[model samples]
Target: MNIWVTSWVAADDGVRLWTATTGAPGASWPVVLVHGGPGLWDYLGPVAQLLDGNRVVHRFDQRGCGRSDPSDDQRVARAVADLECLRRHFGHERWAVIGHSFGATLALAYAWTHPERVASLVPLGSTGLGDWRTPARAEHARRASAQQRARLAELSGRERRSAEEEREFRTLAWFTDHADRERAWAWAAQDAAAPHAINWTANRRLAREVDSWPEETVRARCRRITAPATVVHGAGDPRPAATAAALAAALPHGRFVPIPDAGHHPWREQPSVLRALLLRAIRRA
Candidate 1:
Protein backbone atom coordinates (compact mmCIF):
# COMPACT_ATOMS: atom_id res chain seq x y z
CA MET A 1 0.00 0.00 0.00
CA ASN A 2 1.13 3.57 -0.72
CA ILE A 3 1.60 6.18 2.00
CA TRP A 4 -0.75 9.16 2.22
CA VAL A 5 -1.30 12.10 4.52
CA THR A 6 -4.46 12.42 6.60
CA SER A 7 -5.97 15.64 7.92
CA TRP A 8 -9.15 17.34 9.05
CA VAL A 9 -11.14 20.10 7.34
CA ALA A 10 -13.88 22.22 8.89
CA ALA A 11 -17.19 22.42 7.08
CA ASP A 12 -19.49 25.47 6.99
CA ASP A 13 -21.28 24.34 10.14
CA GLY A 14 -17.95 23.86 11.99
CA VAL A 15 -18.00 20.11 11.59
CA ARG A 16 -14.53 18.64 11.11
CA LEU A 17 -14.43 16.06 8.28
CA TRP A 18 -11.60 13.52 8.14
CA THR A 19 -9.79 13.49 4.79
CA ALA A 20 -6.83 11.85 3.07
CA THR A 21 -4.95 12.32 -0.18
CA THR A 22 -2.68 10.16 -2.35
CA GLY A 23 -0.81 10.55 -5.62
CA ALA A 24 0.92 13.65 -6.99
CA PRO A 25 -0.63 16.90 -5.89
CA GLY A 26 0.45 18.57 -9.12
CA ALA A 27 -1.23 15.95 -11.29
CA SER A 28 -3.23 17.37 -14.15
CA TRP A 29 -6.46 15.73 -13.08
CA PRO A 30 -7.39 15.23 -9.44
CA VAL A 31 -10.09 12.69 -8.59
CA VAL A 32 -12.16 12.52 -5.43
CA LEU A 33 -13.30 9.03 -4.42
CA VAL A 34 -16.66 9.09 -2.62
CA HIS A 35 -17.69 5.94 -0.78
CA GLY A 36 -21.27 4.73 -0.72
CA GLY A 37 -23.54 4.54 2.33
CA PRO A 38 -24.34 7.97 3.71
CA GLY A 39 -23.10 6.70 7.06
CA LEU A 40 -20.48 4.11 6.08
CA TRP A 41 -16.81 4.44 7.04
CA ASP A 42 -14.26 5.48 4.43
CA TYR A 43 -12.73 2.23 3.11
CA LEU A 44 -11.67 3.39 -0.33
CA GLY A 45 -7.91 3.09 0.11
CA PRO A 46 -7.80 0.29 -2.46
CA VAL A 47 -9.70 2.53 -4.87
CA ALA A 48 -7.05 5.20 -4.42
CA GLN A 49 -4.35 2.60 -5.07
CA LEU A 50 -5.80 1.87 -8.49
CA LEU A 51 -5.36 5.43 -9.73
CA ASP A 52 -2.62 6.78 -7.52
CA GLY A 53 0.16 6.83 -10.14
CA ASN A 54 -1.81 8.87 -12.64
CA ARG A 55 -3.93 11.27 -10.64
CA VAL A 56 -4.30 12.76 -7.21
CA VAL A 57 -7.07 10.92 -5.31
CA HIS A 58 -8.95 12.27 -2.32
CA ARG A 59 -11.23 10.40 0.08
CA PHE A 60 -13.04 11.60 3.17
CA ASP A 61 -15.43 10.44 5.84
CA GLN A 62 -18.47 12.68 5.49
CA ARG A 63 -20.03 14.40 8.47
CA GLY A 64 -21.37 12.13 11.23
CA CYS A 65 -19.45 9.11 9.97
CA GLY A 66 -16.11 7.45 10.56
CA ARG A 67 -13.58 9.79 12.18
CA SER A 68 -15.89 12.81 11.87
CA ASP A 69 -17.88 14.01 14.87
CA PRO A 70 -21.43 12.77 15.19
CA SER A 71 -24.18 15.30 14.60
CA ASP A 72 -27.95 15.61 14.14
CA ASP A 73 -27.49 17.40 10.82
CA GLN A 74 -27.53 14.67 8.20
CA ARG A 75 -29.20 16.43 5.34
CA VAL A 76 -28.01 15.84 1.75
CA ALA A 77 -27.63 19.58 1.36
CA ARG A 78 -25.15 19.61 4.22
CA ALA A 79 -23.20 16.83 2.51
CA VAL A 80 -23.00 18.91 -0.65
CA ALA A 81 -21.71 21.82 1.35
CA ASP A 82 -19.06 19.63 2.93
CA LEU A 83 -17.91 18.51 -0.50
CA GLU A 84 -17.49 22.12 -1.55
CA CYS A 85 -15.54 22.80 1.60
CA LEU A 86 -13.30 19.86 0.79
CA ARG A 87 -12.62 21.26 -2.66
CA ARG A 88 -11.63 24.62 -1.25
CA HIS A 89 -9.50 22.97 1.43
CA PHE A 90 -7.52 21.23 -1.30
CA GLY A 91 -7.14 24.50 -3.17
CA HIS A 92 -8.01 22.82 -6.43
CA GLU A 93 -9.59 24.91 -9.16
CA ARG A 94 -11.68 21.89 -10.25
CA TRP A 95 -11.64 18.12 -9.90
CA ALA A 96 -13.31 14.98 -11.13
CA VAL A 97 -15.55 13.10 -8.69
CA ILE A 98 -16.00 9.33 -8.60
CA GLY A 99 -18.81 8.13 -6.35
CA HIS A 100 -20.57 4.85 -5.62
CA SER A 101 -24.23 4.34 -4.65
CA PHE A 102 -25.39 7.10 -2.26
CA GLY A 103 -22.08 8.88 -2.64
CA ALA A 104 -22.90 9.07 -6.35
CA THR A 105 -26.02 10.98 -5.41
CA LEU A 106 -23.97 13.38 -3.31
CA ALA A 107 -21.53 13.89 -6.20
CA LEU A 108 -24.40 14.81 -8.48
CA ALA A 109 -25.86 17.15 -5.89
CA TYR A 110 -22.49 18.91 -5.66
CA ALA A 111 -22.08 19.15 -9.42
CA TRP A 112 -25.62 20.39 -9.83
CA THR A 113 -25.06 23.13 -7.31
CA HIS A 114 -21.60 24.11 -8.57
CA PRO A 115 -21.04 22.80 -12.07
CA GLU A 116 -18.04 25.00 -12.72
CA ARG A 117 -16.16 23.39 -9.85
CA VAL A 118 -16.62 19.91 -11.34
CA ALA A 119 -14.32 18.75 -14.13
CA SER A 120 -15.99 15.36 -14.57
CA LEU A 121 -18.57 13.10 -12.94
CA VAL A 122 -18.27 9.33 -12.59
CA PRO A 123 -21.22 7.67 -10.87
CA LEU A 124 -21.06 3.92 -10.31
CA GLY A 125 -23.93 1.71 -9.14
CA SER A 126 -25.89 4.90 -8.67
CA THR A 127 -29.40 5.31 -7.32
CA GLY A 128 -31.80 6.56 -9.97
CA LEU A 129 -33.44 9.96 -10.35
CA GLY A 130 -36.64 8.99 -8.55
CA ASP A 131 -37.56 6.80 -5.58
CA TRP A 132 -35.27 3.76 -5.83
CA ARG A 133 -36.24 1.99 -2.62
CA THR A 134 -39.46 0.43 -4.00
CA PRO A 135 -37.71 -1.51 -6.76
CA ALA A 136 -34.75 -2.18 -4.55
CA ARG A 137 -37.00 -3.77 -1.93
CA ALA A 138 -38.74 -5.86 -4.56
CA GLU A 139 -35.41 -7.03 -5.97
CA HIS A 140 -34.12 -7.95 -2.52
CA ALA A 141 -37.23 -10.03 -1.85
CA ARG A 142 -36.86 -11.86 -5.12
CA ARG A 143 -33.14 -12.59 -4.67
CA ALA A 144 -32.97 -13.33 -0.96
CA SER A 145 -33.18 -16.85 0.47
CA ALA A 146 -36.12 -17.81 2.68
CA GLN A 147 -34.10 -17.32 5.86
CA GLN A 148 -32.74 -14.02 4.63
CA ARG A 149 -36.22 -12.90 3.68
CA ALA A 150 -37.52 -13.73 7.13
CA ARG A 151 -34.67 -11.83 8.76
CA LEU A 152 -35.36 -8.82 6.59
CA ALA A 153 -39.03 -9.00 7.42
CA GLU A 154 -38.26 -9.08 11.16
CA LEU A 155 -36.02 -6.03 10.85
CA SER A 156 -38.34 -4.07 8.57
CA GLY A 157 -40.48 -2.53 11.32
CA ARG A 158 -37.62 -1.98 13.75
CA GLU A 159 -36.43 1.58 14.23
CA ARG A 160 -33.05 0.83 15.82
CA ARG A 161 -30.19 -1.66 15.33
CA SER A 162 -26.61 -2.17 16.45
CA ALA A 163 -23.73 -1.42 14.10
CA GLU A 164 -23.08 -5.11 13.76
CA GLU A 165 -26.71 -5.79 12.89
CA GLU A 166 -26.78 -2.95 10.40
CA ARG A 167 -23.59 -4.24 8.80
CA GLU A 168 -25.10 -7.69 8.48
CA PHE A 169 -28.28 -6.28 6.96
CA ARG A 170 -26.26 -4.24 4.46
CA THR A 171 -24.14 -7.27 3.56
CA LEU A 172 -27.30 -9.23 2.84
CA ALA A 173 -29.01 -6.40 0.97
CA TRP A 174 -26.07 -5.04 -1.08
CA PHE A 175 -24.61 -8.21 -2.55
CA THR A 176 -26.36 -10.95 -4.51
CA ASP A 177 -24.09 -13.88 -3.66
CA HIS A 178 -21.97 -15.20 -0.82
CA ALA A 179 -18.75 -14.60 -2.72
CA ASP A 180 -19.58 -10.94 -3.23
CA ARG A 181 -20.49 -10.48 0.42
CA GLU A 182 -17.22 -12.04 1.53
CA ARG A 183 -15.29 -9.87 -0.87
CA ALA A 184 -16.93 -6.73 0.52
CA TRP A 185 -16.13 -7.79 4.06
CA ALA A 186 -12.49 -8.41 3.22
CA TRP A 187 -12.17 -5.01 1.56
CA ALA A 188 -13.67 -3.26 4.55
CA ALA A 189 -11.49 -5.16 7.02
CA GLN A 190 -8.41 -3.25 5.83
CA ASP A 191 -9.66 0.01 7.30
CA ALA A 192 -9.07 1.04 10.92
CA ALA A 193 -11.84 -0.21 13.19
CA ALA A 194 -13.77 2.54 14.89
CA PRO A 195 -16.82 2.00 17.06
CA HIS A 196 -19.93 3.71 15.67
CA ALA A 197 -18.12 4.44 12.38
CA ILE A 198 -21.35 3.67 10.64
CA ASN A 199 -23.86 5.93 12.38
CA TRP A 200 -27.34 4.41 12.21
CA THR A 201 -29.06 7.63 13.26
CA ALA A 202 -27.60 9.56 10.33
CA ASN A 203 -28.15 6.69 7.96
CA ARG A 204 -31.85 6.45 8.79
CA ARG A 205 -32.34 10.20 8.63
CA LEU A 206 -30.56 10.60 5.26
CA ALA A 207 -32.27 7.52 3.82
CA ARG A 208 -35.70 9.03 4.46
CA GLU A 209 -34.60 12.27 2.80
CA VAL A 210 -33.31 10.36 -0.25
CA ASP A 211 -36.55 8.38 -0.55
CA SER A 212 -38.58 11.56 -0.81
CA TRP A 213 -36.18 13.41 -3.16
CA PRO A 214 -38.10 14.85 -6.14
CA GLU A 215 -37.53 13.25 -9.54
CA GLU A 216 -38.21 16.41 -11.51
CA THR A 217 -35.72 18.36 -9.44
CA VAL A 218 -32.99 15.77 -9.93
CA ARG A 219 -33.64 15.57 -13.67
CA ALA A 220 -33.59 19.35 -14.05
CA ARG A 221 -30.23 19.58 -12.29
CA CYS A 222 -28.77 16.63 -14.19
CA ARG A 223 -29.61 18.21 -17.49
CA ARG A 224 -27.72 21.29 -16.50
CA ILE A 225 -24.47 19.41 -15.82
CA THR A 226 -22.17 20.08 -18.78
CA ALA A 227 -19.13 18.37 -17.32
CA PRO A 228 -18.01 15.12 -18.94
CA ALA A 229 -19.81 12.28 -17.11
CA THR A 230 -19.66 8.52 -17.13
CA VAL A 231 -22.40 6.44 -15.51
CA VAL A 232 -21.30 2.89 -14.82
CA HIS A 233 -23.57 0.05 -13.65
CA GLY A 234 -23.07 -3.60 -12.88
CA ALA A 235 -25.14 -6.16 -14.78
CA GLY A 236 -25.93 -8.24 -11.70
CA ASP A 237 -26.77 -5.24 -9.50
CA PRO A 238 -30.32 -5.24 -8.15
CA ARG A 239 -30.90 -1.69 -9.29
CA PRO A 240 -32.05 -1.78 -12.91
CA ALA A 241 -29.43 -0.82 -15.51
CA ALA A 242 -32.02 1.36 -17.22
CA THR A 243 -31.81 3.79 -14.32
CA ALA A 244 -28.13 4.32 -15.02
CA ALA A 245 -28.77 4.61 -18.75
CA ALA A 246 -31.46 7.20 -18.15
CA LEU A 247 -29.19 9.23 -15.90
CA ALA A 248 -26.41 9.08 -18.47
CA ALA A 249 -28.81 10.15 -21.18
CA ALA A 250 -29.95 13.08 -19.11
CA LEU A 251 -26.48 14.62 -18.94
CA PRO A 252 -25.38 16.81 -21.84
CA HIS A 253 -22.00 15.06 -21.87
CA GLY A 254 -22.60 11.66 -20.38
CA ARG A 255 -22.28 8.02 -21.41
CA PHE A 256 -23.07 4.68 -19.80
CA VAL A 257 -20.83 1.62 -19.36
CA PRO A 258 -22.29 -1.64 -18.10
CA ILE A 259 -19.94 -4.13 -16.47
CA PRO A 260 -20.88 -7.72 -17.16
CA ASP A 261 -21.41 -10.29 -14.40
CA ALA A 262 -20.74 -7.71 -11.68
CA GLY A 263 -22.74 -6.40 -8.73
CA HIS A 264 -23.03 -3.00 -7.06
CA HIS A 265 -19.40 -3.04 -5.98
CA PRO A 266 -17.68 -3.53 -9.30
CA TRP A 267 -14.23 -2.91 -7.84
CA ARG A 268 -14.68 -5.96 -5.64
CA GLU A 269 -16.28 -8.09 -8.35
CA GLN A 270 -14.18 -6.96 -11.34
CA PRO A 271 -11.32 -4.68 -10.39
CA SER A 272 -9.58 -4.73 -13.75
CA VAL A 273 -12.66 -3.72 -15.66
CA LEU A 274 -13.55 -1.08 -13.08
CA ARG A 275 -10.02 0.27 -13.21
CA ALA A 276 -10.14 0.50 -16.98
CA LEU A 277 -13.45 2.33 -16.92
CA LEU A 278 -12.16 4.72 -14.28
CA LEU A 279 -9.01 5.43 -16.28
CA ARG A 280 -11.13 6.09 -19.35
CA ALA A 281 -13.29 8.54 -17.41
CA ILE A 282 -10.21 10.32 -16.10
CA ARG A 283 -8.78 10.62 -19.58
CA ARG A 284 -12.01 12.03 -20.91
CA ALA A 285 -12.12 14.59 -18.17
Candidate 2:
Protein backbone atom coordinates (compact mmCIF):
# COMPACT_ATOMS: atom_id res chain seq x y z
CA MET A 1 0.00 0.00 0.00
CA ASN A 2 1.12 3.56 -0.67
CA ILE A 3 1.84 5.83 2.29
CA TRP A 4 0.81 9.52 2.30
CA VAL A 5 2.96 12.27 3.77
CA THR A 6 1.14 15.32 5.12
CA SER A 7 2.56 18.78 5.77
CA TRP A 8 2.01 22.53 5.34
CA VAL A 9 3.06 24.65 2.38
CA ALA A 10 3.30 28.41 2.85
CA ALA A 11 1.77 30.61 0.18
CA ASP A 12 3.13 33.92 -1.14
CA ASP A 13 1.07 35.83 1.44
CA GLY A 14 2.44 33.75 4.35
CA VAL A 15 -0.77 31.77 4.61
CA ARG A 16 -0.18 28.11 5.35
CA LEU A 17 -2.09 25.48 3.38
CA TRP A 18 -2.18 21.81 4.42
CA THR A 19 -1.00 19.35 1.77
CA ALA A 20 -0.59 15.61 1.42
CA THR A 21 1.40 13.59 -1.07
CA THR A 22 2.15 9.98 -1.98
CA GLY A 23 5.03 8.44 -3.94
CA ALA A 24 8.60 9.60 -4.46
CA PRO A 25 9.96 12.40 -6.62
CA GLY A 26 11.40 11.36 -10.00
CA ALA A 27 9.29 8.17 -9.90
CA SER A 28 6.82 9.68 -12.36
CA TRP A 29 5.19 12.98 -13.30
CA PRO A 30 3.32 14.45 -10.33
CA VAL A 31 -0.40 15.06 -10.30
CA VAL A 32 -2.25 17.58 -8.11
CA LEU A 33 -5.84 16.90 -7.13
CA VAL A 34 -8.13 19.86 -6.42
CA HIS A 35 -11.29 19.01 -4.51
CA GLY A 36 -14.68 20.64 -5.09
CA GLY A 37 -15.99 23.70 -3.25
CA PRO A 38 -14.45 27.09 -2.93
CA GLY A 39 -15.01 26.50 0.81
CA LEU A 40 -14.52 22.75 1.37
CA TRP A 41 -11.23 21.18 2.40
CA ASP A 42 -9.19 18.57 0.60
CA TYR A 43 -11.50 15.55 0.32
CA LEU A 44 -9.85 13.95 -2.69
CA GLY A 45 -7.90 11.32 -0.76
CA PRO A 46 -9.79 8.50 -2.46
CA VAL A 47 -9.09 10.00 -5.89
CA ALA A 48 -5.39 10.15 -5.07
CA GLN A 49 -5.35 6.52 -3.96
CA LEU A 50 -7.02 5.49 -7.23
CA LEU A 51 -4.05 6.64 -9.30
CA ASP A 52 -1.16 4.40 -10.30
CA GLY A 53 1.13 3.45 -7.43
CA ASN A 54 4.21 4.56 -9.37
CA ARG A 55 2.89 8.12 -9.73
CA VAL A 56 3.20 10.92 -7.19
CA VAL A 57 -0.08 12.49 -6.14
CA HIS A 58 -0.58 15.79 -4.32
CA ARG A 59 -3.65 17.16 -2.53
CA PHE A 60 -4.11 20.42 -0.66
CA ASP A 61 -6.70 22.49 1.17
CA GLN A 62 -7.04 25.94 -0.34
CA ARG A 63 -6.27 28.98 1.79
CA GLY A 64 -8.97 29.85 4.37
CA CYS A 65 -10.48 26.38 4.21
CA GLY A 66 -9.91 23.17 6.14
CA ARG A 67 -6.40 23.04 7.66
CA SER A 68 -5.28 26.18 5.86
CA ASP A 69 -4.85 29.52 7.63
CA PRO A 70 -7.86 31.85 7.61
CA SER A 71 -7.59 34.93 5.38
CA ASP A 72 -9.85 37.76 4.30
CA ASP A 73 -8.35 37.77 0.82
CA GLN A 74 -10.40 35.22 -1.09
CA ARG A 75 -10.38 36.17 -4.76
CA VAL A 76 -10.25 33.85 -7.79
CA ALA A 77 -6.93 35.38 -8.79
CA ARG A 78 -5.53 34.85 -5.30
CA ALA A 79 -6.54 31.20 -5.35
CA VAL A 80 -4.82 30.77 -8.72
CA ALA A 81 -1.67 32.40 -7.31
CA ASP A 82 -1.71 30.08 -4.32
CA LEU A 83 -1.79 27.07 -6.66
CA GLU A 84 1.26 28.47 -8.44
CA CYS A 85 2.99 28.80 -5.08
CA LEU A 86 2.37 25.12 -4.41
CA ARG A 87 3.85 24.22 -7.79
CA ARG A 88 7.00 26.32 -7.24
CA HIS A 89 7.41 24.96 -3.72
CA PHE A 90 7.42 21.43 -5.11
CA GLY A 91 9.94 22.45 -7.82
CA HIS A 92 7.88 20.99 -10.64
CA GLU A 93 8.39 22.44 -14.12
CA ARG A 94 4.93 21.26 -15.11
CA TRP A 95 2.34 18.88 -13.68
CA ALA A 96 -1.01 17.29 -14.43
CA VAL A 97 -3.93 19.23 -12.88
CA ILE A 98 -7.13 17.49 -11.87
CA GLY A 99 -10.15 19.15 -10.24
CA HIS A 100 -13.72 18.29 -9.24
CA SER A 101 -16.87 20.44 -9.14
CA PHE A 102 -16.05 24.12 -8.64
CA GLY A 103 -12.42 23.11 -8.30
CA ALA A 104 -12.58 22.09 -11.95
CA THR A 105 -13.32 25.64 -13.08
CA LEU A 106 -10.54 26.92 -10.86
CA ALA A 107 -8.17 24.39 -12.44
CA LEU A 108 -9.17 25.57 -15.91
CA ALA A 109 -8.62 29.18 -14.87
CA TYR A 110 -5.18 28.20 -13.56
CA ALA A 111 -4.31 26.62 -16.87
CA TRP A 112 -5.47 29.75 -18.69
CA THR A 113 -3.23 31.85 -16.46
CA HIS A 114 -0.23 29.55 -16.64
CA PRO A 115 -0.63 27.35 -19.67
CA GLU A 116 3.06 26.55 -19.84
CA ARG A 117 2.96 24.97 -16.39
CA VAL A 118 0.04 22.62 -17.04
CA ALA A 119 1.04 19.36 -18.72
CA SER A 120 -2.58 18.16 -18.88
CA LEU A 121 -5.98 19.07 -17.43
CA VAL A 122 -8.86 17.00 -16.10
CA PRO A 123 -12.06 18.75 -15.01
CA LEU A 124 -14.28 16.13 -13.38
CA GLY A 125 -17.93 17.06 -12.90
CA SER A 126 -17.13 20.70 -13.53
CA THR A 127 -19.65 23.45 -13.04
CA GLY A 128 -19.37 24.38 -16.69
CA LEU A 129 -19.05 27.81 -18.25
CA GLY A 130 -22.44 29.53 -18.71
CA ASP A 131 -25.64 29.41 -16.68
CA TRP A 132 -25.99 25.81 -15.48
CA ARG A 133 -27.14 26.47 -11.90
CA THR A 134 -30.82 27.09 -12.72
CA PRO A 135 -31.27 23.78 -14.56
CA ALA A 136 -29.16 22.00 -11.99
CA ARG A 137 -31.37 23.28 -9.17
CA ALA A 138 -34.45 22.21 -11.11
CA GLU A 139 -33.08 18.69 -11.59
CA HIS A 140 -32.08 18.47 -7.94
CA ALA A 141 -35.58 19.48 -6.91
CA ARG A 142 -37.08 16.96 -9.29
CA ARG A 143 -34.96 14.21 -7.75
CA ALA A 144 -35.86 15.10 -4.14
CA SER A 145 -39.12 13.84 -2.59
CA ALA A 146 -41.72 16.11 -1.02
CA GLN A 147 -40.72 15.04 2.52
CA GLN A 148 -37.05 15.58 1.78
CA ARG A 149 -37.80 19.01 0.34
CA ALA A 150 -39.85 19.98 3.38
CA ARG A 151 -37.11 18.85 5.73
CA LEU A 152 -34.51 20.78 3.73
CA ALA A 153 -36.70 23.90 3.71
CA GLU A 154 -37.28 23.70 7.45
CA LEU A 155 -33.57 23.28 8.21
CA SER A 156 -32.53 26.10 5.89
CA GLY A 157 -35.19 28.44 7.32
CA ARG A 158 -33.77 28.04 10.80
CA GLU A 159 -31.52 30.74 12.24
CA ARG A 160 -29.33 28.09 13.84
CA ARG A 161 -29.03 24.34 13.66
CA SER A 162 -27.79 21.78 16.16
CA ALA A 163 -24.94 19.52 14.99
CA GLU A 164 -27.35 16.73 14.20
CA GLU A 165 -29.70 19.11 12.42
CA GLU A 166 -26.81 20.48 10.38
CA ARG A 167 -25.82 16.99 9.35
CA GLU A 168 -29.40 16.18 8.40
CA PHE A 169 -29.66 19.39 6.40
CA ARG A 170 -26.50 18.61 4.49
CA THR A 171 -27.58 15.05 3.85
CA LEU A 172 -30.82 16.25 2.32
CA ALA A 173 -29.10 18.94 0.30
CA TRP A 174 -26.60 16.51 -1.23
CA PHE A 175 -28.90 13.52 -1.61
CA THR A 176 -29.44 14.15 -5.32
CA ASP A 177 -25.73 14.12 -6.19
CA HIS A 178 -25.56 10.37 -6.65
CA ALA A 179 -27.02 8.15 -9.36
CA ASP A 180 -27.99 5.45 -6.87
CA ARG A 181 -30.87 7.09 -5.03
CA GLU A 182 -31.21 4.13 -2.64
CA ARG A 183 -27.63 4.56 -1.39
CA ALA A 184 -27.37 8.36 -1.86
CA TRP A 185 -28.72 9.06 1.63
CA ALA A 186 -26.05 6.96 3.26
CA TRP A 187 -23.33 8.46 1.08
CA ALA A 188 -24.55 12.03 1.62
CA ALA A 189 -24.80 11.42 5.36
CA GLN A 190 -21.18 10.27 5.35
CA ASP A 191 -20.20 13.37 3.38
CA ALA A 192 -22.10 15.62 5.79
CA ALA A 193 -19.94 14.35 8.62
CA ALA A 194 -16.74 15.69 7.08
CA PRO A 195 -14.45 17.30 9.70
CA HIS A 196 -14.09 20.74 8.13
CA ALA A 197 -16.89 23.24 8.17
CA ILE A 198 -17.68 25.37 5.11
CA ASN A 199 -16.08 28.82 4.89
CA TRP A 200 -19.06 30.88 3.80
CA THR A 201 -17.05 34.07 3.40
CA ALA A 202 -14.50 32.46 1.11
CA ASN A 203 -17.25 30.76 -0.83
CA ARG A 204 -19.11 34.00 -1.45
CA ARG A 205 -16.03 36.01 -2.31
CA LEU A 206 -14.53 33.54 -4.76
CA ALA A 207 -17.91 32.67 -6.28
CA ARG A 208 -18.52 36.32 -7.11
CA GLU A 209 -15.17 36.55 -8.84
CA VAL A 210 -15.88 33.44 -10.83
CA ASP A 211 -19.33 34.66 -11.82
CA SER A 212 -17.98 37.91 -13.21
CA TRP A 213 -16.13 36.10 -15.99
CA PRO A 214 -18.05 36.15 -19.27
CA GLU A 215 -18.59 32.87 -21.12
CA GLU A 216 -16.94 34.21 -24.24
CA THR A 217 -13.92 35.35 -22.22
CA VAL A 218 -13.41 31.90 -20.69
CA ARG A 219 -13.89 30.31 -24.10
CA ALA A 220 -11.22 32.58 -25.54
CA ARG A 221 -8.88 31.59 -22.70
CA CYS A 222 -9.59 27.91 -23.24
CA ARG A 223 -8.72 28.23 -26.90
CA ARG A 224 -5.30 29.56 -25.92
CA ILE A 225 -4.46 26.62 -23.65
CA THR A 226 -2.64 23.95 -25.67
CA ALA A 227 -2.50 21.33 -22.90
CA PRO A 228 -4.53 18.18 -23.44
CA ALA A 229 -7.82 18.49 -21.49
CA THR A 230 -10.37 15.79 -20.73
CA VAL A 231 -13.67 17.02 -19.33
CA VAL A 232 -15.46 14.22 -17.49
CA HIS A 233 -19.07 14.34 -16.33
CA GLY A 234 -21.70 11.88 -15.11
CA ALA A 235 -24.76 11.32 -17.24
CA GLY A 236 -27.11 11.60 -14.26
CA ASP A 237 -25.59 14.79 -12.82
CA PRO A 238 -28.09 17.57 -12.14
CA ARG A 239 -25.68 19.87 -13.93
CA PRO A 240 -26.19 19.01 -17.59
CA ALA A 241 -23.33 17.16 -19.28
CA ALA A 242 -23.89 19.24 -22.44
CA THR A 243 -22.27 22.20 -20.69
CA ALA A 244 -19.21 20.04 -20.11
CA ALA A 245 -19.21 19.16 -23.79
CA ALA A 246 -19.22 22.86 -24.61
CA LEU A 247 -16.16 23.36 -22.41
CA ALA A 248 -14.42 20.53 -24.26
CA ALA A 249 -15.32 22.08 -27.59
CA ALA A 250 -13.78 25.37 -26.39
CA LEU A 251 -10.38 23.77 -25.77
CA PRO A 252 -8.10 23.09 -28.73
CA HIS A 253 -7.22 19.59 -27.52
CA GLY A 254 -10.13 18.88 -25.19
CA ARG A 255 -12.38 15.81 -25.10
CA PHE A 256 -15.59 15.22 -23.19
CA VAL A 257 -16.23 11.83 -21.55
CA PRO A 258 -19.61 11.00 -20.04
CA ILE A 259 -19.94 8.37 -17.34
CA PRO A 260 -23.20 6.44 -17.73
CA ASP A 261 -25.62 6.06 -14.79
CA ALA A 262 -23.47 8.32 -12.60
CA GLY A 263 -24.17 11.68 -10.98
CA HIS A 264 -22.14 14.67 -9.78
CA HIS A 265 -19.54 12.53 -8.06
CA PRO A 266 -19.02 9.70 -10.56
CA TRP A 267 -16.21 8.04 -8.61
CA ARG A 268 -18.58 7.29 -5.74
CA GLU A 269 -20.67 5.05 -8.04
CA GLN A 270 -18.28 4.23 -10.86
CA PRO A 271 -14.79 4.16 -9.40
CA SER A 272 -13.23 1.79 -11.93
CA VAL A 273 -14.41 3.76 -14.96
CA LEU A 274 -13.28 7.08 -13.49
CA ARG A 275 -9.90 5.57 -12.62
CA ALA A 276 -9.44 4.29 -16.14
CA LEU A 277 -10.16 7.73 -17.62
CA LEU A 278 -7.82 9.41 -15.13
CA LEU A 279 -5.03 6.93 -15.94
CA ARG A 280 -5.52 7.51 -19.65
CA ALA A 281 -5.19 11.30 -19.15
CA ILE A 282 -2.07 10.93 -17.00
CA ARG A 283 -0.43 8.58 -19.50
CA ARG A 284 -1.14 10.99 -22.35
CA ALA A 285 0.23 13.87 -20.28
**Candidate 1 lowest-lDDT run of ten:** 185-194
Worst 10-residue lDDT window, candidate 2? 21-30
User: Any residue pairs clashing in model 1, and if so which?
Assistant: none
Those runs of model 1 whose alpha carbons end farther than 4 Å from true positions after fitting are 155-167, 177-197
lDDT of 2 by residue, 1-285 (tens): 275678999998899999998865555578999987879888888888788477888899999999989989988889899899999998899999999998998899899999999999999999876788888999999999999899999998998888999899989999899989899989999999987888889888888888888888899988878799999999999998888898988899999999998998887899999999998887777
lDDT of 1: 0.79
Which prediction has the highest lDDT against the true structure? 2
Quick one: RMSD of model 1?
A: 2.9
